[model samples]
Target: MEKQHSFWEREEWLKPPDLMIIGGGIVGASTAIFYKKRFPKHDVILVDKGIAPEGASTRNAGFACIGSVSEHLADLAVSGGETVFSRIVRRWNGLQLLRETCGDEVMDYQNTGGYEIFTDEKIYETCAGKIPWFNQKLKERLGLEDVYSEREYEGYPAIFNRVEGAINSGKLMRFLHERFTESGVRTWWNSRVERVEPGSVMFENGFQINPKKTVIAVNGFVQRLVNLPVKPARGFVFVTKPIPGLKWKGTFHFDEGYVYFRNIGERLLLGGGRNVAKEEETTDQFGTNQKIKEYLTRFANVTLNLPEKWEIDVEWSGIMGMTDNKEPVLQEVKPGLWAAAGLSGMGIAIGMQLAKELVSKLED
Candidate 1:
């Protein structure tokens, strides 16, 4: 039995809106703000399943990085040089938009630089050989020479990216939440959308919302709503207790970004390695696997060489939406129904930008 709302309450809060965006994650919330900004007279509403921003938006590792050296090289191998270059440009644009919309200070954004550690001599040599070529291509696009510099850190061999930075993921999401509220966009948390009709949305609680336009921004959870090409890829992460003298600083990626770690003040945050168990890690569940945990523990001990007795403070997993082509699907699926998913684990920077772009297209 569903509790019914009074006529006054229904008229005030349950009425149809001009734009209703599902999934109050980064993309969904930004989409609401963008639409409201473009159409001030229209009523925009954002609904989320959880009370807070669920999915990877708030659970990410907080690395404000575009792409690592080895990751870029792998992308180039698969998508070719031109396509890879264009994707990088989009990532740069996304970063700029994030900074412009939410001030750097509010997001706790910092340009402390980033690094990629080579685990072996062969890998180091292979990446070193391609550094010159890769640097030239990136410099051409960025209009700056020597974006990456090969360096030695402690006993580990690494390459440094001068343009990389870090941010507090919590702060960034909260900042966006506040901005959305200030912009007069209505947000309904704990509202799980069950079905989407042509001009209405059916909620799990038996309530229906008839909005003029609906945007589905659910990333990893898209399969539950639509039959799209998007699939959920799980990423596990763990953090260590504060170390008094941690040698590593800034963000880091190893083995083509399958493994990454970064320092947050005195504590260290490490994540990734879904590539090791691709089949098991493809589910949308947010649980840890013993095999993956063992691998991460070994990497932290051997690769990062953290001191013994450093406690595992916390561990969690996030699901990222990925596609075969590694490109986000940002288009109108049907009449008055739009979607933005398939970020491929690169959603932090690019998701907000895609929202703005989608809003512009919808307005036009």
Candidate 2:
């Protein structure tokens, strides 16, 4: 079929915007929202490749949390205490900002709290030992005392985080889209950006416009657009049919946040087996790995102790942008072209806050 464009459509495509944002995921949407707030009168447009904000934004497990107890301790080992604590603070603050920005009701946010469970006694004991130190260190940053408490949950030894929560990712993204629409910011969904330049955005459909400034927030799809220190790590998430007598509630993590699950109503949503098949799961392609899926299936029943015979209702995958250091990769690649990608599966926690920081730098 021939590509169709009305007279007005052609005019709209040809006109230059004051700011052009590529990608419409949480980071891109957040960037546009922040841009408009900074320059309301200026023309800012968001172009998304999918029908809506695609990739991880609309396709994550919906945990509005940062690192769990063991995960934070492991991070401290790798990046040291200062770097790890600073990141945790940013992620904690980001979740609050998102809750405040989108409002708790519309985003379906639940501060029902979160927990990190461990099957291994050794790891559990190590993590439990750090609770006091972590609580004391983090209290000064997050201003919330007693952040982590060692306890038993659902028959498993777990470390509970008082402030961690979950949010409906769809609702949160919709809230952002609505904010942009209500604020008169133009959004172009189904627009595939081919390349990004200092002041120009070229689409796969042969549409090109030279906006005064451009921001690339494409996340996992960043390789084609820029030479950033990032790569794709695919993740799978599956939901179970409502099981009778479901006892689990609130967000959970195991194996240092690699495996996570939570209750959506009476049903269970579980995901994360990238650690099982690291090489196979490191692609931008969107498909579930068989080994990973099988591992998660057994994990749900055996490890999580969920009732057997509970059928999976749906299964899907998302590509996450990751860096070696696992921190968000934000850089001004060129004079007027900036790229903010590599959220390292922390998009829900850090995407918006990164955009806020990016905009401040953009204005500078």
lDDT tens digits, residue span 226-303, model 1: 778999999999989998898878889899888999998889999998988999999888899888889989988888
List the candidate 2 regions with Cα displacement exceeding 4 Å: 1-13
TM-score of 1: 0.97
Q: What is the lDDT of candidate 2?
A: 0.89
Task: Give lDDT for model 1.
Answer: 0.87
Evaluated at residue 354, the lDDT of candidate 2 is 95
- Cα lDDT for residue 225, candidate 1: 83
Off by over 4 Å in 1: 1-3
Prediction 2 TM-score vs. true: 0.96
Candidate 1: lDDT of 298?
92
Worst 10 residues of 1 by lDDT: 138-147
List all candidate RMSDs to the true structure: 1.3, 1.9
